[model samples]
Target chain A: MTATKEHVTIKGNKDGLVFLFNDHCEFPDLLSELQYKLEKSHQQILSGPTIDVHIKLGERELDVQQEEEIKKLVGHHGNLLIQSIESTPKEQIEKNIHQDLKIMNGIVRSGQSIHEDAPILFMGDVNPGGMISSNGDIYVMGALRGLAHAGKNGNKDAIIAASYMRPTQLRIANIVSRSPDESANEGAYMEFAYLDEDHMQVGKISELHKVRPVALQF
Target chain B: MGEAIVVTSGKGGVGKTTSSANIGTALAILGKKVCLVDTDIGLRNLDVVMGLENRIIYDLVDVIEENCRLAQALVKDKRFEELYFLPAAQTKDKDAVQPEDIKKIIESLKPDFDYIIIDCPAGIEGGFRNAVAGADRAIVVSTPEISSVRDADRVIGLLEGANIKNPKLIINRVRPNMMKSGDMMDIDEVCAILAIDLLGVVPDDQQVIKSGNIGEPTVMNPTSNAAVAYRNIARRILGDSVPLMNLDGKKGVFNKLKKIMGIG
Candidate 1:
């Protein structure tokens, strides 16, 4: 007896695999199948050390529940890879992007221009010359050295989050922010960006509600 | 060991493929086995620039993806015994290949050649990663324009982060007259900002376009100004201290005309 080996269309990327198949499969069934196969080879090394991945959905469409299911299976703060979106409609694609999370992976090279309008989650290092524009909250799970702009749509309530934040230039909408000087480039903690009554400021995510001095110590 | 050097410029229309073809042909003339691998995938132009597209039986994707054997994928140059062309797949995009897959392919070629020159595709995406993955060294090809230089600077950081350390630079399409008159940014300023070692400077030469149309690398045309620059870079690659080609003076009549019109 032959098992129905699903006609999985594998779209390869720099970091990992993007499996495009039917949305009819149950969430548990899909997750189990992926786990059964991936864990066989990845059992030795599949946690942490997030690898950036992109899912380019050019033709196929995915439901909201399936998207959420996939996200749950991948787990938060895990190795990130972009999934199919080109195939999905623009609004759906925008809605599917992690609004509260910034997804960036790989080294952001100089002159490499990047503009994302979603709440961003980056898994890679932001090198010197790159720039990102996002409307929602931006979170960096890695080092950010390039010019990054959060709340580009003039949302005064937005914040920029990073695991390592030493931006050459930071902007939250019209408000301009600068790095803490070349000598003060050590950022080992997660930082967040928000607007004050008249000034746009960034503070540690843990201390978002807490009040501190006008000028940050960092 | 024969080194694989990927000539990349992330921004499109910046002559990445043109520079790769010229440099590969130049290296072969120096008696080194050279293979130019076009990793541009779906938007390949190296074969067309080299005038070898019609002769291609397979491509770089076919060899690595196991659609064909390496020997079958390699298209030998008509005139040079040491030169070969590995074209890209016109049907597939950057996603068809990966960095690891490219590394595996280059590792296999280590024992057989003196140089594996990859023509990197535009963008910092999959094609870019695959091209640079197997490269022992990289030559970022860029114009004198600020945008190109800026992108080149970013590419340098990318290469460094990937541990391809100390990638040499090739500044192409330099119009010395423009720099002399302050119309264009001089190479010195570009070098100062990027702080990378210089490989060689190629002057603007119309023969480069004509040569491409004829399926020939400018370097093969001995008298072409740009060819002299590519030849100089090839020599520099082999540890030879050849002088850089000057912008205005070369054997080409077209080059001379450009000097008269102050266009080059």
Candidate 2:
């Protein structure tokens, strides 16, 4: 199809709204023109304190790398200048998740740490080197292979639950399980460990005194 | 239709350099044009592993930032005539190289070589992002240990999130004897969780370390179990249906690819 006359297209990247330049204009020139256009376009967007706008130029075949780079750069700054119709999505694991983090998946890998102000519940395993710290309680649907520390700020009432609980180390409030008993070799079952009258004890993950936490807002 | 593959493990010390050197060397030895881009930046050893560290006159950062021509920075492998090593700068930080710079460099390489294997730095940071910038495929290298496996799972998740479904696995340094002895997790045990296709299983061979010290890829030495495993992985990457090098002699083709990639 023939190019739209003076094409001004808008799209959503990981950062926010991005306006691309067609082959019609030069990159540096187009960038300057975009600033002028945004300055003149609408009032509501201009009313914001700051805005993030990502731009990429050249005849490059827009790939994921380019998209992610623009995003990281924009996010490094502040909010966007344009009130775009499209929105940049926050990470799924943290959406509307406050007070307690509910990571539906298991096996929190390395380079991924869930540091929230709430409790964390995993329906799966927390693999080694992956970290989990919470203010309320910590729960794992599967195994707890990685590091799980509950009551990080000294909430001794905090507890940890897992289906197959064999973590490298465990900590509740300030007390930590440096070395637990040898992991069982039989049918690996669920277990929950908590401060039983200030003494650490283990039982089935379901048998422990726990409250089913509803999702909280950010 | 050439491509670059970043062999990455989200966690460190999971055999990214070893696999990069071996796979790049294997492809070259197989008579395919290959260039190994060391995206590790600041801690590069692709040159050393290929036994060509002494010949690194220039680095990848230089080539990308237009300081040197791509041809000037490439160091030919000591063994394979077709293989070239592009080492990363030992002093510069990862941020010195942008994702676009890496993408431009790889795009320039796509037409010249049959394969470009990028030895990605550990973690999902800027370096990891830069390493994977322009690659057509990815290979997440990991070991049997829970730490490595967990990291591999996260790396796989990142790859999937990037829509890179062709990511394969090279479970390195696995001791089959230990698997038999119940001391180590078997290939099946790992496959059941990570759920990615198994390219090859490298038996824990001592030659891997020795080869690294001498600046030679283990695959260059035919005797090492690691070498055979690396070669099998190269074959698998080429869309060849080579069987898994089973020391116990009891693994299957379908089962290997079944769990990983969630494919048949």
Candidate 3:
């Protein structure tokens, strides 16, 4: 620590290492300290199996160039992959916007697909052979008799809901389930599918809040 | 001015050509000047279905390629003075006719006919696009089979995307018995899935196949139940209110009795 002001600190955990930079210090000073610390650290600490490195920029704003410089500096160290750069309010707002629920009107026809990183609310029917995939949850206001894949990239929290849940197939994260052959023509009611203990489960939509509270968070 | 209607189904053998032939013939029987255009290209069958294959001297490609005039290419129907058939070129592929060329051909034919029915080839390919390019309306044909309904849904979606709005649905080859037994999809289910206006439902008829074999449309057979369904569809197309034919087989005996008595 130079002059008792530690601008950068590196912590390791089971998941990966974390680079915490002090927001009080000037960005140039923090960058230099991070560079010096990585250079002086024991080779073994940087040379281990490839692991994620999360950079926490608490209350600090970084322009595009400064962020790139930080990434390059960390990448110079061995086996350290920059997984994410997390800042507070700005990043959170941007994330919320990206995860915003997108509404689409009209039917998804056979061989048609809608894939997105955000949650999707389709207002019309998803015909057989149609597909809808998302990294977040999927909500269909009309019949969903086609394929639906939610929580892509192993986001186990994602859910798939439909007004008429007679889906040909449902996929959540890494799990998949096909509808039963008989698919009783129960009067159209809202229903949903989610991953429970790594298994796929279907239930009435009213129980969604109790099952996945995050889904009700808007 | 004539209105061009494209009859299409995304899946093959769902009776696109058969519906085209029958609808065109029905329109002609209604005393409308009608022309049938076969846009199936190399796999042309509308001419054969209409029993005009023997008269296809100059095909659609000949007119578009300027080898012959449009009038020179159209073959007049033997039975109807107002009905004409434009056969597709058997040797050339779908790429032979461009969308612009079809639009121009339909525009030219519009002034001379009351209706121009274009038989679209199965599948959403260049041929389908070419057929739909000039149509002011569309008729999507589907059987009561799951595969046919799925394909019809796809074609209807494509038609709407192409700005051919409100495409009518024809549930062809319906088996009321199988539907009652829950073995086949019903007309209501098909209409719900496709979400389009119902044009007509032609029940499964052995005579349809026999008529095709003899190069005659079932719509020409007055006694055929499918023929009545086609005529009702034609009247509906003319903006005449026609009730849907009762598909319940229970009406068969009663109808036969009525016909035999001639209402006494």
Candidate 4:
């Protein structure tokens, strides 16, 4: 095969070494490529004390037999350990390239805190005195009665959405906003809070779907 | 196996010691041999509340440190023959005793007593963990105030995390008049917030203070409303389906009026 016909690529990452396989390649072709690459770098890779090899299957799910086959193939190469296998779907890999979404199911009680790197989907009520902070957006299926701090990493585009948005305190990025004098009326509809210019603004969830007309620049 | 129940309140002055003394006494009165273990250590108050402070020769630390036998530390109650109290050491702090130490102490006491009531200290620190470590069930005490209820919620979460499942709640110091006027949160509201089963509701009764001053739990005084509440709580703890006390204190009059008015 020519140098351009590369189907398997090996690279080092913060979490040990990773082996990437092209989705379009056949299983046999991918295995042969992996074997060839390992054979070439076997001396250098196997020199260290049992290093973990993270196998990244791009857009391809591995069955138990295929995983066992890959494990057997890697074992023949040397003392390298297969730490984990990451098989990413095409849609999810494309949508949340940088965002991590965590879905939690339970009530966030008083004095309890939940912190996440990316967005969070809470399936329960955030009670009074509870806190939830996220780097990206936060979606609560139940009442958001406690403190919610979204866009914690200074990403102002992050929004907080809840069925009942009567939060004790709502913070987006650097700006902080408390509940209004009279708490917002609780209804069947969902509410969203987002950063508008320098201040935080609360609106109906439907407002997010509406397209705002851009100001014409002469 | 004997049931070891820990009476805990995350916030102080919510009547954890009082509940322990009374519940242990009530259980003893119900013909069950009960021992109250005061695990507060430094700020020990269960012995004082149980009126056996002067009788404490060997405290809980003595039992764990092998300074004395477990039987030597148990002080017999003057009122109930079956009721006993294990006082906590006032000089030593919480770190003096580990959770495993408390577990071993309770395990030794298990065969002798029918119910081991542990009076847990306020706050979710080492002392609280030590108290709850040995207990099979837990009773969380909270007042009607927001601060007490909030702390109780936190304590409940910690209890569940510690694998103490389905801890019962006791809403103490509930003022019915304030509840009627919407000034204080009602029992139902507190129950809703905590999301725990209501074991009992002790109305704000002046008799509780009077009894505590004399080193007597109100559960001893049959006439006192708080005593009745504590007895009902004890019964519930025994798996009896006792209905919650009507805190309004006008259950009889209200029922009579409703009957006369043909509303009931």
Candidate 5:
């Protein structure tokens, strides 16, 4: 009932008792704090009957090992029934953002048009004159020598990445750009294209990690 | 069952009819019963290329429409006894027949012939669909030009979509001199763009044009360079691993002579 706990905090609601874990806290410290708080409150909270304990991890991805540790720590009291482990708003949004990714496994030949509402992962080459349009980001595992239009639904944050970026034309949001007359060196160097301000910018994939936005920091 | 192959090119004037005529004729001369079907409809040209235009008593539409028997519509070749030609309907358009009708006609001929070659019309329209409907295999033709190669790529995509696995490529009208001067694309360049197995390469030979004018396929003339290329392609079609012909023209001969003389 102490709200001053640094890493873990406990509260009661109409549904059940809720445990909130801070994402930035260390895992061992959080586990100890949870164990101490649950044991101290067990007698008072479980006086009537066993109540459901809903564990919420804010903005933190939980691995199986950490989840098992938390479950063991909470189950030590034997006076609570663990309802569910809920993710933070940030983690939930991240999961939902990538759930619509579509993966295709074939060459996109000339005159072929591919349309997608979500992100796309192509495992083959996009030959010249072929086109791909997506509302989300696009990632090509092979060469991209065609036209790629990302952020088709006005999402300025969408990006296009490819192993060999030699597209004839690239469009991000409302911006458009064409490939240069002379191509770069022919190698398996990965490249990416994204909208910077109002213009489309092309750069090496390694450089993208340095200047990514907060939402796409990972 | 006999294999039914379709020769197709999405763009016009890429030598689909000529390749079909030569390939069919060469196969027939090799003692295999071959029948060439012209599915170009109103733009029929295979009969003239095969030199059987005068002998066309009935057309493909007649056989499909049940106006004439299938055997009566087939024109016998004058040179090769095993070779036969089915002329297209010049008066009617591509709508004269459906894909199912062509499939049915090709199925009927499968038992009598060892190879049934279909000459598809240019463009990915109804005529092209009908020509490819009955084919178990496909051969895409292209030239060195960018437009032709682009169209060939589209046709290859369509063929793959139609479930014709591993369709072969034929680079026709290739000029070695132009390729050497960097004015035209080489066989390797075309193959790289198309990403398909190359069946053969036919050099731009005057003999092929002359043979076409005379209504005789160049494969009939053994001395012609194109004839040798066609024969090699036909051998490859019969599951023979024939090496590609050296179509580098005079430049390749000069290189060999320079190597013999040990001159820089």
Candidate 6:
């Protein structure tokens, strides 16, 4: 080997060890260098408690198999733990803002229908014969006496919540459920409808945080 | 110019004609020049209800077609002071007159009367549209029954879509005994569902059917509960702050007596 090139540089910060791989070098050369560096530091890593290691690929596009290979190589060192793998120049992703959350205010009376492709927050009563459907979650701040269909676009994770949970019918994705013949005294409590393993289930709004942690991202 | 009020109900037999005739008569009784226009062409009954069927030489279609002038078609109601009646043509259907024709007729009548009450035909069809064409205000009539209330709600939605905002609600034929027994929806329940301002609530009184049979409006009867309710509604239309009549007073007393007898 003509003077060994520094294809991988390891540094320690408050967060953990950072492995900055050189982009100009060949990917195989970079991976081998990273393995060598981690092995060399194996003794040094054992001296202390397990430390988090972060891998940073600068402008290097790695396939999923290559990334897994790198992760397995890093895992070979017992004391060295990989916390995260990131690319400096990430791929661009466009998020639609309108499909995130929509707010509306009014009484949806009989013969009126409201449809949306995104999550909706309605702040009024939905009388009998009125309908509200959405591709995502449906949140009503008032009495929901009419029909509400959530996850209409086949999003099974969608939910329906209301202050007064007396809906005539509730639909989520492919599941359909109707109100009981005698409306049970749900008692003015806030309630939500969600899909549980292909079955429609109704639960109190208080338990929504744990049931769907990702839905509480906002 | 005077205001043109459209009395409409989507379902038939919910007392749209009766409510229109009584409200118009009550307004006349209040010393206002009221003109009642029957827009239920081909199924005309306002004339018969108003007892002016014998005087209908010219009809709404005749006035719209320019065969007769507006004044020539208006039949004067000599019993009520300054009340006029315009009968619908029994031969011509609802399509005979367009919304513009009704607008023109109403505009002409607005200059001479304090109120131009248009009696809209049942259902949300061409006749209903024609009746509501030139109205400045709307009164949506509904009964306590579920079907009637549902139809009323649909009609209200249509009226709002037509840019007629804040249409007042009149709950007709409310049987207090049934409401007390939980068999019928109460006034508050109806109001909550409709979500509109309560113009008035008329109780279900046998006197109403009797008066209708005699071609006399229930408002003309001083002892009838519906007449008092209609009079109050008329007063409300005139911007008077009148309290709602005690709907439960008589029924509450009867309920108390029944409970004492262990018969309720």
Tens-digit lDDT string for candidate 1 (B1-264): 678888987778878888888888888888889888888889999999988889988887888779899888888997997898888899877888888988988888767899999999888877888899999999988888878877887778788867898888888888888999877879886775566789988888889888889888888788877888888888899999876655755549887786567654
Residue runs of model 5 more than 4 Å from their true location after superposition: A1-101, A181-189, A211-218, B251-264
- DockQ winner between candidates 2 and 3: 3
TM-score of each: 0.56, 0.61, 0.78, 0.77, 0.77, 0.77
Q: Is candidate 3 or candidate 4 better by lDDT?
A: 3
Error of 6 at B155 (Å): 0.9
Score chain A of each prediction against the true chain A by TM-score and list the results: 0.49, 0.46, 0.61, 0.60, 0.53, 0.54
Highest-DockQ candidate: 6
Q: Give me the overall lDDT of model 1.
A: 0.76
Order the candidates by DockQ, highest first. 6, 5, 4, 3, 1, 2
Question: Which of the CAPRI classes, incorrect, acceptable, medium or high, describes model 2?
Answer: acceptable
Please give, for residues A44-146, the per-residue lDDT of candidate 6 as tens digits. 7645688899988887778999999999888877777999887755333223344368889898988999998778999998888999999889999998988
Candidate 6 off by > 4 Å: A1-99, A183-188, A216-218, B249-264
Worst 10 residues of 1 chain A by lDDT: A209-218
* Candidate 4 per-residue lDDT over residues B1-264, each given as its tens digit: 688999998999998988888888889888899999999989998877777888889999999899999899899987887988899999999999999999999998999888999999999989999999999999999999989988998998889888999999998988889999878887777886787899998888899889888898888899988999999989988889877665666668778687567564
**Candidate 5 residue B239 C-alpha distance from true site, Å:** 1.0
How accurate locally, in lDDT, is each candidate? 0.76, 0.75, 0.88, 0.86, 0.88, 0.89
Higher-DockQ candidate of 1 and 3: 3
Which scores greater on lDDT, model 1 or model 5? Answer: 5
Q: Write the residue-wise lDDT of candidate 2 on A1-218 in tens digits.
A: 13434434545566755666554554444444444455555334545466556453434333566445444433443445433223223443354454246556645754456765677767765666678878777878776767888888888877887777767778888787744465543324677777866677777656553432432222
* Model 6, global lDDT: 0.89
Candidate 3's displacement at residue B167, Å, is 1.3
Question: In the order shown, what is each candidate's alpha-carbon RMSD?
Answer: 20.6, 18.6, 6.7, 7.7, 7.4, 11.7
Lowest lDDT block of 10, candidate 1 chain B: B242-251
| Candidate 4 pairs with clashing backbones | none
Cα lDDT tens digits for candidate 4, A1-218: 56667888888888778988898879998988788777774458867677778988989988999999999998875668889899888888666643456778787888899998868888988878999989878889987888999989898878888988778899999999987675234333598888889688888888865522321100
Model 4 chain B scores worst on lDDT over the 10 consecutive residues at: B255-264
Task: Tell me how many residue pairs clash in candidate 2.
Answer: 14
Of the candidates numbered 2 and 3, which has the greater TM-score value?
Answer: 3
Give the per-residue lDDT of model 3 (tens digit) for B1-264: 999999999999989999999999999999999999999999988877778888889999999999999999999997987999989999999988899999999999999999999999988989888999999999999998888899988888789888999999999998888999988887778877777899999988888899998899999998888999999999999999887776775557778686566541
